[model samples]
Each structure stands twice: as C-alpha cells, then as structure tokens.
Target: MPAQLVWFRRDLRVRDHPALVAAAEAGEVLPAFVLDPALERAGDARTAAMLTALEALHRATDGALVVRRGKPEEVIPALVAEAGAEAVHVSGETTPFGRARDRRVERSLDVPLVATGTPYAVSPGRVRKGDGGPFRVFTPFSRAWLEHGWRAPAELPSQHRWVRRVEGEAIPDAPEVEANLAWSAEEPALERWHEFLDGPIDDYDASRDRPDLDGTSRMSIALKLGAVHPRTLLADLDRVAPKRSKAAQRSLKRYQTELAWREFYADVVFHHPRSAWHDFTDALARIPYDEPGASFVAWQEGRTGFPMVDAGMRQLRAEGWMHNRVRMLAASFLTKDLHVWWGHGAQHFLDRLADGDIASNNHGWQWTAGTGTDASPYFRVFNPVLQGQRFDPTGDYVRRWVPELRHLEGKRVHEPWKADDGYAHDYPERILDHAAERQEALDRYEAAKG
Candidate 1:
C-alpha cells in the first residue's frame, strides 16, 4: 500500500476534512500535527485553543495524532522520508505568515504537495469586482460572495487501514500561558451551535446588540478550528428559515450577515496582506498613540473602573471569550478612550480571546481605530456606561462578570460610583473621565488629519 502524509494545522477535526479524506485515498494515512516554534512564541489564548483542539482530535482518532515540534519545511520532509509516504496533503492557509510558510514547505517536499479547501467556503481573492480588483467595501463584497457559492461539505472516510506501526510523540497538554482563561474543546462548541439554532438565532437581530440576552452564535472558535464547518451552520439556517416568523427571518438574515463579515475580513486580509500589521489606509498612519503604562495595564486587568468595560475585560479573562457587542465597546475603549495603538489592543486580544483569528481580530481592531475599510468614524466613540445601561439594562451581564458590582441594584450597577458613599466598598470609582478623554481623542484625530 502507498503511504500518504496528512498535515493538520488550524483545521483540527477529522469529520468533513477534505485533506484527510484525500490522503486516505492514496494509502494508509499518517496524520501529523507540528508544534511549530513560531506558534508557541505567539503565546496567547489562540495557542491554548489549538492545544485543546489537538487533544480532542487525539481522543477522537484513538490516539492517532502524530506530534512533531519544528519548522514544517524541515519536519514535513523528514516525516515523509521516515514514513515512506508517496505524497503529502494539507488544507491551505490564508494568513500572511501561513501563506509564506506553506510555500516554503511545498518547495522543500520532493513529492506532490496537494493544497485544498482554504479556511473559508469561498477562498479569499477568488471573488472580485467589475474591474477585476478586490472589493474594498463589505456590502458589495458580500453580494459578490453570495453569488459565488461554496462547495458542499465533504464526507469523512468511514474506515482507516493502518499499513505501518509507527509510534508518534504524545499530544501536548493545553498550554499554561493564559491559565486564568477557561476554554473547552469541540464538544461544547457543538452544544453552543445547537443552542443558537434552537433559540437565539431567530431573535438575533433584535437581541444581538442587547448584550443581556443570548442572541448570537458563539461557535466562532469551532469554525476557526474546523471542528464544525460553516456549511453545517449555513444549511441549518436555510432549513429553519421557511418555518420562522417574519421577525425571525429578519433576525436570521442579520445573523447570517455577521458570518459574511467573517469571510469579508478574511478576504480583506488575503488581498491586503500588509493590513494585517499596518493601517489599511496609509494616511491614518499618522494617528498618535499614548505610551503603554498604567492605563493599558488596568484595561487588560479589567479594573478600568468603567462598569461595562470592566465587565467585558473580566469576562474575557475568566471565560476566554466576551460578548460581541462588549468586544466592540472594549476595543473602542482601548483605541478611542485611552488613545492606545490598535496594534497594542490587537495583541492583548490575541492573548486572551479563544476565537481570535488574525483576519477577524486585526481588522476588527483596525475598524474600531478608524484605520480600515468601512471603519467606524473616529468621532463616534462608544460610551461604556451608557452602553451598559442601554444593552445590559438589568445588570445581569455586569454582575455576572464584575462581581464587585453585584450588590448594586438595577441600572445603578452601570455607574456604581453614583450610588451612596458606602458603595465605594463594592466597586471602584470611574477609571478615566470619559468626556475629557473623548475630546483628547478627537483633537488627536483632527491633528493627524491636519
């Protein structure tokens, strides 16, 4: 029997994995996952999430996951040689670093290196506008994306025939880098998807912005890890659409648009690779940033003294995730309130968020900082307290995450400092005056434009 090597990267699952299935067709498959030193150096919640997914994959595969720690360009060739594999197969990656690394691996390998099914349904740079250039804005891009539909999800191989008895290294335990943040493997992700489909997706449009309710699909991590394919979710939406009431259809459409945003950002990163680290608009590079110090530390630690902001940060630290609306508010606080660089905020988020992907996190940070395509205007700063009162009105979300403010009743939890003097024992005072900081940010933006 011919030997085939299958490399696993961000796509960790066996079911509906095109590369794994293709490799199995050639011969007895040797499934391998490399713990690249570069990834470990990135050190954040993303790395921890990868480790958790790998552990789950091992369990699912009956301990068949091969573990090697090195650069893929060198390691893959070595593995291919040792296993006597005829060819190697892998899913394509879209990130700048990943693209470059895959190219190097392809050149180094002697046999054919097959790359398939990118991290998205429609691969980035595949869809374009009239002039044959990439779509600079999202609305037109989303329209073009829908017109260009994706392939149906592939089926998993039913049987595995092992030709050689090769013992690979053990799968590493979840990293200790972000010990405070709790992240589960694939099982919870599946449950979350079912729960969203069963309840919140029908009411998504109305309640998504209202952080108090479970209004959004929390399956981003699963999607990112490929434990669940996007097609599965898309099919579910279609199945339930006809049965839903008018309001539910409207809400479901809004929810689907967010998924499009994920693809939109992915396409943006693929087309404008430099935007991954730099401003998408060169003119906005002149924006000033505050020195990283006390305020930055306080923001990361969730002691910002602003109830909504603090709650978001606390939830991130405790759960390895935050509500989508709160994510926007928290990001706006960093870039607009503190005038910190978006790159700084991006790094911090990458360190904490379990679902953090370079395409989404980096672009989302740039959008909040007013430096990306379709960015929020620099003047439209989010008011953290008002946001909490308006969205999380009952203070359920705030109390759950920021326990210090638990004793404060009703909407008063949003501004605990406004309560009686004895309330000082419960919550800290306002960290930074929002009005004053807003003006400072405006002046800085204006000065940069001038």
Candidate 2:
C-alpha cells in the first residue's frame, strides 16, 4: 500500500479521529507532529501538559510518532518526500493562524493535502441561519447548532499499518511549572470523562457555578488538545442519558451547551478573525482605558484586596486554571474596576492557562468587558463582594486560594473590609472601591457610545 502522512495538530488521539481513520483506509500511515515556534508560545504549565500529551501519543503510535522542530510548511513537505507519501492528511484548521498556515502548506505540497475533520464537534462555518448566513447572536446560533447535530464518532480502522521508514527528533523537555497538572494524556482524559459522566455530571447544573467544589468536568485541556473529541462526549451523553436521572439529563444538556458555546466562539472568529484580538463590536471601541500598571500587577499577583478576585487570580497562577465563574468576575474587575484593557487580561490568561484557545479566551474577556457579542453591552459591572457571596457563599473557595483570608471565617472572607480584624492576616487593602469604579466604568461606556 502507498504511504500517507497524517499531520497531527490539535487532534492528537487515534480514537474517533476522522483524519486518522481516512488515512488508515487509504494506505499505511506515518504519524507526525511539528513543534513549530509559532505554536510553542504557551506558558510553562500548558507547554508541560502538551509535551506530556505528545509523549502519550508517541507511545500510542507504537513508537513511530515523528517529532520534528520547524515550520510545518517546511517540515511536512520534507517528511512527505522522505517517506514517499502519496498525500498529507490532517484535521481541518479553523483559527485564523491555523487556517492560513494550512493553506500555505497545501499550496507548497507536491501532492494533495486532504482535510477530513476539525478540533470542534461541529466545524466552524457549518451552522448557519435559515437564510444561509452566519448567526450573529449566540442564542440563535446555539439553537441552530443543536438542530444541526454532528455525526457519530468515527470508528477506528479494523486493520492499519504504520509507516516507520523515516526518523524524527525526540520530544523536548518541558519547563518547570508550579501548579499541579493531573492526567493529561488520551487514556487519562477519557477516564476523567467517564468518571464525570457517571457521577459528578448529575450535579453539574447546580454546582458548576460554585468554585469551592470540583463541579466541572476539567476536560477543557483535553478538548483543546483533541485528546478526546466533543463528538465522543456527545455520543456518550446520549447513551447514558436514558439510564441516568432527570438531574443528570439536565446536567448533560447544560454540558452540551457549554461545548456549543466553544463552537460558537470559534465560528465567530472564523467569520471575523480580527475579533480574536479587537473588540467584536463597537460597544467599547473608543472607551478610555488605563494602562496596565501597578494595579494590574496587583490583580495578577492575586492581591487585589477583593477576596474572590484575589482567590481566582491565585488559583490561576497556582493551577494554570480558574473556575469559569471566577474567570468572569476576575475579568470584570480588571476591565471595569481597574479600567485596564481586556486584551491585557486575555494575554495573561493565554500565557498561564493549559486549556487556553484564542477564540474562547479573548472572546470571553470581550464578553465580560462588554466589547464582544454580549447582548446587553457595557454598563453591567460585576460586584466582586456580591459575586463572591453568591457563588462562593461559604467563602471556602476564597479561603482555599487566598491564604491571607483563610483567617476570616464564613462569609466574612468575601468582605474583609467589613470585619474589624479583616486585615489582621496582612491582606492588602481594597485597591479601589467597587461602587466608585462601577460608576466610572458606566461613565466611560457612555462617553465611548456618544
């Protein structure tokens, strides 16, 4: 059989991999990964997790996985020539950079560069309005996404052969990361998914908003790296829903919607690539923003004096991940309270987050900053104290991450300023008053609109 080169990017695992299945059916497959400088700008935690995942993939390929360091455009074609590959197969790319790089590689390749699937359950640009145009808002897009369901997970090839003629570099060592990274490889990610589906998924709807509990699936990095596909998760949800309780069913549905939000953001980026870095809309296009200075440093250091914001920031640096609810609250504090640009916060997140993706992280910041696809736009500022009290009611979440506030008991942790001994533990004073900053944020929004 002719040899084919399967260039793995975001999609790393072999199971439910459309490109891998297609390549296997066509010919003997050579699995290759390129350590492009462009894609290696992740923080220590993300880089460490990714390298670990690649090692797992290497073992899965029966020690035939090719790891090369260079631009994919140069590396892939060279591999094709060396292996005598008939064609190069890959899961399609959606992000602006990925799409452009793929196009360049396609143009440079001597043979066909066939694309079979994407990192998303539904590839960006697939779901559209009844009129065939892109959906501007999320609610409509999510409705259409559910209506336009995806295919069943792809089956593994019955019999496949590996092309091991070519040799490549060894996977490089990872930088030192302070936070703990749990199971990151394909098998481990799958194990975590099944565990969530069996138990925690039942209370996901109720507990997802709480930061104190391990209520989330923790599958963001898995999905981002394509250690597991969303299609597989969706299929499993369908299989287990009937056997589970109504609460589980509701939780499963909510989980599915969260996945939809990911896809929706990708679609928005596909349609408007500039939105990845700039404001999606003109809501805050000309808003006066303060430079990220001392206050910004305080926010990053988790010393913002707001226990909830401090806790979220501390959690981010410690774990390379933060609770989703806290992410929104932290973002709101930065943009609204400190008047810093959302991009600064987004960049910091991408640097530290193991599961960071441009579409989701940047757009999420934009959403909180009232500059993205949010329907209400600016003026909706989060009250850190209230948000902390509501979500982390017992203040356990704040106490867990913020050691200084651990001395404060119960809800007192959320509002240390109110307690006579609030600063007894040496926690920093509130950087700025939320009520005063809230009015300032609104005033800036009005000026920008005018």
**Top-scoring candidate (lDDT):** 2
Cα-based TM-score, every candidate: 0.95, 0.98
lDDT of 2 at 216: 94
TM-score of 2: 0.98
| Clash pairs for candidate 2 | none
Candidate 2 stretches with Cα past 4 Å from truth are none
What residue runs in model 1 are displaced by over 4 Å at the alpha carbon?
160-164, 176-184
Question: Candidate 2's C-alpha lDDT?
Answer: 0.91
Choose the strongest candidate by TM-score: 2
Query: What is candidate 2's lDDT per residue for 50-110, written digit by digit as tens?
Result: 8878999999999999999999889999999999999999999999999999999998899
Query: Model 1 clash pairs?
Result: none
How high is the lDDT of residue 257 in model 2?
90
